[model samples]
Target: MTLTLTSLGGAGTVTGSRHLLEYEGRRILIDCGLFQGYKALRQRNWAPFPIDPKSIDAIVLTHA
Candidate 1:
């Protein structure tokens, strides 16, 4: 079994928070908030995701 963690957002700033976890044969996502604040951060929202959305098996939001 193998485990991998990737941060889709919430790296060098606040607002949008997303974390992708892949283990075994499953891919789980935690947090799916939108970016808000500086233009640069917000612009990130428009960019394509680092990973494929279809590759994700499930999504679990820790907060609203």
Candidate 2:
């Protein structure tokens, strides 16, 4: 059993808190948020997702 956690966002800043958890051949996304702050940060919102959205097995949002 191999499990890996990847931080898609919210590493340094306080917005766009997204995390990807992969285990047992399953991909789980946590906290799908949007970037909010300076223009540079907000521009990240327009960038494409790191992985294919369809590849995710489930999404677990930590907050609304």
Listed per model in order, the count of residue pairs whose N, CA or C atoms clash below 3 Å is 0, 0
lDDT of 2: 0.94
Model 2: residues with Cα > 4 Å off, grouped in runs: none
Per-residue alpha-carbon lDDT of model 1 for 1-64, expressed as tens digits? Answer: 8898988889877788999998998999888878999888889889888788898899998877
- What is each predicted model's overall lDDT from 0 to 1? 0.87, 0.94
Which pairs clash (backbone N, Cα, C closer than 3 Å) in model 2? none
User: Which candidate has the top score in lDDT?
Assistant: 2
Worst 10 residues of 2 by lDDT: 9-18
lDDT of 2 by residue, 1-64 (tens): 9999999999899999999999999999998999999999999999999789999999998789
Q: What is the TM-score of each candidate against the true structure?
A: 0.87, 0.95
Please state the error at residue 12 of candidate 1 in Å.
1.0
Please give the distance, in angstroms, between residue 33's alpha carbon in candidate 2 and its true position after superposition. 0.9
